[model samples]
Target: MRELAKVQGCLDRARGGLGAVLVVSGEAGIGKSRLLREAARHASDSGFAVHVGAAEQMTQTRPFGPWLDALEITPSSRDEDLRSVAVLLRAAILASAGELGSATHVVIEDLVDLVERLAAEVPRMIVIEDLQWADDATVLTARAVARSAAHLRVLLVVSHRTGGLPAIGRRLRRELLDLDVATDLPLAELDHAAAQGLAEELAGDAMWPAVHPQVEAARGNPLLIELLVAAGGRSGEGDLRCALREHVRDRTWALGDDGIRTLQYAALLGQRFSPDLLAEVLGRPPVEVASALQRAIEQQLLISSGHDLAFRHDLIRDTLGEELPQAVRASMHATIGRTLARTGARSPEIARHAALGAPRGDREALELLRRAAVEYRRLAPAVTVDLLTRAESLADERLPDQVELELLWALAATGRTGSCIERAERRLQDQPQPATAAAVHACLGLIRQRTNDLDGARTEFDTAVALAAEAGQIPAAYLADAAST
Candidate 1:
C-alpha cells in the first residue's frame, strides 16, 4: 500500500505538471507485474490517462518496442510524405523500428517530444513492463524522459527483474536511482506475517490455519504459495507439474544441457547444495561443476550463497526434476546414492537414493532396502511401507520372498491389514510352488487371527500346513509355527 500510495503521489504530481518516474525492481514471481496493475488501476480511478505496454524476449530486436506498443503506433500508409511523417510520432517510430532499429539520439528526442505533447493534453501515466528484456533504445528513452520530467506531465513507470539484466539496461536502473524525480521501489520477499495475510486472502478464513504449514515452504514467494495450494491433490499434481514445467522451461530456455543436468543433480541433493558434493555426484571436475553453476546463477535460475548454491525457487527445482526421464532419473539417483555413500551421508538419505535408483531383482538392492526399512520402521512406519513396497515391485519375479514378507509385516503394523490380506490372496491365486503357497496362506491366517475370525483363521492355517506337507521335501513344522497363536 505504501508503494501504491507513492505511485498515487506520482500521479498527483504529474497532474500538477511536476512528473516523476517510478522504477520497480524485484526477482521473478515477486509481484512486479501485479503491482504495476494496481498502480494503473489507481491512476485510472484518479482521472489520469493510463497506457500500458510490455517488453518481450521475442521482441527485443525491435527498438522502442515498448513505446510503439504503448502508443499502438503503426503507420497506415508506408508511402506517406516526409511532411506527414514529421507531423506524426507514429510514423517516426514505425520508421525507427525499420531502419534505425538501434535507436539513435534523434529517436530518443522524438519520444520525449511526443510524451510531452500527450501529457500536455491530459495527465498521462505510461507503464512499461519486463524492462529487463527492453532494447537499448527503450532504456535510453526512459532515461531521457526522466531527465525531462520537470517539463512533462507524464509519470513513466518501469518494472523489471533485478537479475539477468543486460549491460545497457543496468545504466537506466542506476541513473533512475540517482535522479531526484525517480522514486525507487525495490520489492523484497514477504515476511512471514505478510505472507500469511496474503495466503489467507487467497484461501479465505476457512483455510487460514490449513495453509499455515505451507507458507514457509513457499519461501516467501507469492506465486509458489498459490501453486503449492493449487497442487494439493493427486490430480492437481499432474496439472501443477505441467503448468510449472512450461513456465520454468520458458525461464530456463537459455540454459545449456550441462546447466540443466547440473540443476537436475542439484534437485536430487535438495534445494541448497555444496559444489564439491555436486561435483562428486556428477563425476565431473570441481571446476567444471562450478562453471555450470555460475551459468545457472547468471540466468537467475540459481542463487549463490557463499560456497553453496540454491535454486532461486523450489518450483524451478521441481520442474527440472519432473522433466528428467524415468530411466535417466533412476540412473542419476543411482550415481547419487553411490556418491553420498562414499561421502558418508546419512543412512536415510542414501536409503532414499538406493530405493529410487535400484534396478529390478538385484539382491544387493534388497539388502539395502531391508536395512533402510529397519532404520525407518520405528521412526516412520509409512516411509518403511513405501520403501518395502518399492523393493517388492523390484522383486516381482521372486514373490513370497523376504522383502515381500517384510512389506506385509510393515503394512500390518500400519493398520493396512486389508491391503496385506488382498496381496497374499492374489499371490496364492497365482499358484506358485507349494512352499510359496504355504507362505501366502500363513500370512492370511495371521491376518484372520488378528481380525478375531478364529474359524477363518483355522481354515487358512490348515491350508498352509497341508501345502507345506504336500511339497514333501519341505517341513510342515515351520509353516505350523508361522500360523501359531
Candidate 2:
C-alpha cells in the first residue's frame, strides 16, 4: 500500500511537466506486477495516457521485443515532428537490411524522441513489466527513453525481480539506480496477519485450521497462498511441494531443454550459484552456461544476484529438488560436492552436499564433515551437532578415536550434556589413551558446567588436567584454565 502511494507520487510529479522513472523491484509473486497494474489504473483515472507491455521469456531473444510491444505510433499525430519520428521508428522495425550499428542507433534515438514528442502533447505513462526479461536492445532503448523524457511530461514505470538479471539487465538496473529523477519502490512479502487476512478472503467460508499450515508454508508469498486457497485449503506438505512445482512449471514451460537442464543443475547447487560453478558441475563451457542462464532469466525462472544466479523463489528450488529422483539427486550432489572440494569452497558447504551424496563410511566425507563441525561449533552449535552426527554416521574403524571425541565435545557444546556424558563414560570404560581420556573428561566437564554442577565440572577438569599433564600435552594447561574460568 505504501508502495502504491509512492508510485502515485511519481505520477503526480510527472503531471507537473517533470518526467520520472519508477522501478518496482521484488522477488517473484511478491506483487510487483500487481502494483504496476494498480499504478496503471490510477494513471488512467487521472486522465493520463498509459501504455503497458510485458517482456516475455519466449521472446527475449528477439531484438527490441518489449519496445515493439509497448509503443504504437499512428500517422495521425497533429505535430509534424512527432509523426516524423514515429515514421522513422516504424521504418527501422520494418527494415529488410541495413548496417546493424547504424540502424540500432537510429531506432533507439527515434523511439526516445517519439515518446518525448507524444508526452509534450499530453501527459503519458509507460509501464513495462518484467524488465529483467527484456531483450538487451529493448532495455537500451528504454534507458534512452528514460533519459530523454527526464524533463518532459512522461512517466516511465518498470518492474523487475530484485536479482538474477543478465549483464544487460544489470546495466539497466544500474542506470536506473543512478537516476536522480527516479523512484525506487521495493516490495516485501506481507506479514502473517495480512497474509492470514488475504487467505481468509480467498478461502471464503472454507477457511479451516488446516489452512494455517499452508499459510505458514507459503511464508507470505501471495501467489502460493492463493494457489493453496484455490485448492480449498486441502494442501498438506506434499501437496504444497506439488503446488509449488506446478507453479514453477507453468512459468518455465517455454524454456528450452538447455535452460531446463541448467535449472536442474542450479537447483542441485543450491538456490544461489555461479555460472562458473554450474559450468564445472555440468562439464559445459562457461559461455554455454551463460546462455542457458540468460534463457532462464528471460523466462523468469532465475534472477541475477550479483555474481550469482538465484531462483526467483526459494520454493522453486525446493520444488525442483523434490522432483528429482533419489539416485539422480544423490549423484548430482556428489558431483557438486567433489567440484566444490576441488575449488576449495567452504567446509560447511562441501560437507552439506557430501553428507547427502557420499556413500556411508566415506573417509573424505567424514573428514569434511568433522572439519565442518569444527567450523560451525561457535557460529552455530546446532549446525555443529548435525555435522558431527553425520560424521558419526560415517565413522568406522578407519576414523581416528579423536574424531569420536570431537563429536562428543561438539554435542556437549550444543547443551546435549546428558548424551555427551553417557558417550564419554562408555568410551572411558575402554581404558583409552591418555589424550583420549583427557578429551572425554574435558567434554564431561563442559557438560557439567552447562548443567550448573560447578563442583563436578571442577573435578572432571582436574582429572583431565592430570591426564593431559601425565601425557605431557599442552591441552592440560588449557583445561585447567577452562575450569578456573
Candidate 3:
C-alpha cells in the first residue's frame, strides 16, 4: 500500500548500512499495527532479520514485556546469547540483588549491545507495537536501542496512538523527533477515493450507493470502514457504539472494579479529567485514584496529559458513557456536581452536572441552573436562555418567583421575545411579589420593543416603573435603569 512505501524506505536504508527509525502514529483502528506487519514483510523479503513485539495494554506491569516477546528468550532457549541477554535483562528489571539503578543501566547497555550483534550478523529490523502502553523500563530500553541504531544496520519501527501518551511515551517521542536518524510517519485517514476503493474491495459487486454513506460515516478509519462493510452498511448508532465498545474491551475488561469505576467517573467528567476531581467524585483518596489512573495509562486506555488524563479516543469515552445505566450516570453526575460545588467551580460546569444529575423538581438543580443562567446572561445569552429554560421546566409551583423573572429576562435577552412574552404573561397570572412583578413587566417591555410595538412597550415599562417604586429602593432603581433602555 502507499503507506507501506515509507516503511519500506526505512528497511532499504537499513540494508544500505544506515540505521533508521520509523515511528508510525495514528488513532485507534487506523491500521498502525497492520502497517508494522507490512514493514516486517518487506524487511524479511529483503533478507533482513525481523523481530516483532507487541506491548500488552493489560500486562504492562511486567517489565520488558515487549522486549522479552521480541527476543523470544525462555530460560531453556537453544540460543546461548539470547538466553544470556534475557537472564541479565530479567535481573535488571527485577533487581533481585536490590541494586535497581545500576541494574537498569546494565539492561540498557546489554540491549544496545544485543541489537548491534544482531545487526552485525545481518541487517535487523525490530517492530514494537503499542509503545504507548510500554512500561518505563521498556521505553528506556527502546530509546537506548534507537540511539545506538544510528550507526548499525538496524531499522526500528515503533507504533503508538497519537493521543493519550503517558509522560514516558511523550518524552520518547520528543527524543525521536530531535534525532536525525528517526522518521515520524503520522498516518492520516484515507481520502474519499481510497476509502471508496477499500469499501468496494470489501463488499465486491454488492457495493453501491450504500457504500458511499458508510465510507462517509467511517471518516477514513480503516477498521471502522471494514466493520461498516462487514455489517452490510447497516451500521446504525447502536451498532457503531457496540463496535467501539468491543474494540477496546480487552484493554478495559482486565481492569479491577476500582479501575472500572475510575474509568466510569472519568467518562462522566468528559474527555479530559483531573485525578483530584476524579478522586473527589469517587470519594476515594488521591493515592488510590492515582493508582487506577496509572493502570489505565499502562493499558493505553487513558493518556496522561499534564495534570489530567484523557481517553485515547473520544469513541472510547462515548462507548463507556452509552453503556452506563441512566440512573447511575445521573447519580454520578450529581455526585460530580456536588464535588465541583465544593471546589468553587464555575457556574456552567456545576450547572451541567446538576441539571443532568438532579431528577425532576430537584430544588438544588433548579437553583444551580438559575445561578448558571445569571452567570451566562451577559457572557452568553444563548447559554443563559438554555439554563433558565431547563430550570423553568424543573421548577414547581412553590418555586420562587425570581426564577421565572430570570427565565423571562434570559429569554428576552436571546431575542426569543415570543417565548419571553408568554412566560411573563403566565407569571403575571400567578400574581408574583411586587419586586418579581416589576421584573416580569420589565421583561415584557423589552419583548414588546423587539416586536416593534412601541406603545405596548411604553405602557409595560410605565407599569414596571410604578410597581418597582412601590416595592422598594432596589427594585425601583433596577426597573428605572431597565425602562430607560
Task: List clash counts for every candidate, in order.
Answer: 0, 6, 1
Q: Compared with the true structure, what per-residue lDDT tens digits does model 1 show for residues 63-145?
A: 77787678655555342332232445445466655566433576677777777877888888998888888987788888888
What candidate 1 gets wrong by more than 4 Å, as runs, is 77-103, 205-212, 231-238, 254-258, 279-301, 313-315, 338-355, 361-485
In candidate 2 the C-alpha lDDT for residue 203 amounts to: 77
Ranking by lDDT: 3, 2, 1
Return the lDDT, model 3, position 383. Answer: 88
RMSD to truth, every model: 8.4, 8.4, 6.3
TM-score of 2: 0.60
In order of appearance, the predictions have TM-scores of 0.66, 0.60, 0.66
Compare candidates 1 and 3 on lDDT and give the better one. Answer: 3
Q: Model 2 over residues 148-186: C-alpha lDDT tens digits?
A: 766888899888876646688788878986887789888
Candidate 3 per-residue C-alpha lDDT over 241-325 given as tens digits, one digit per residue, 9 for 90 to 100: 6666786676676578768888988999999998888898888899988877876766556887887888766767877787789
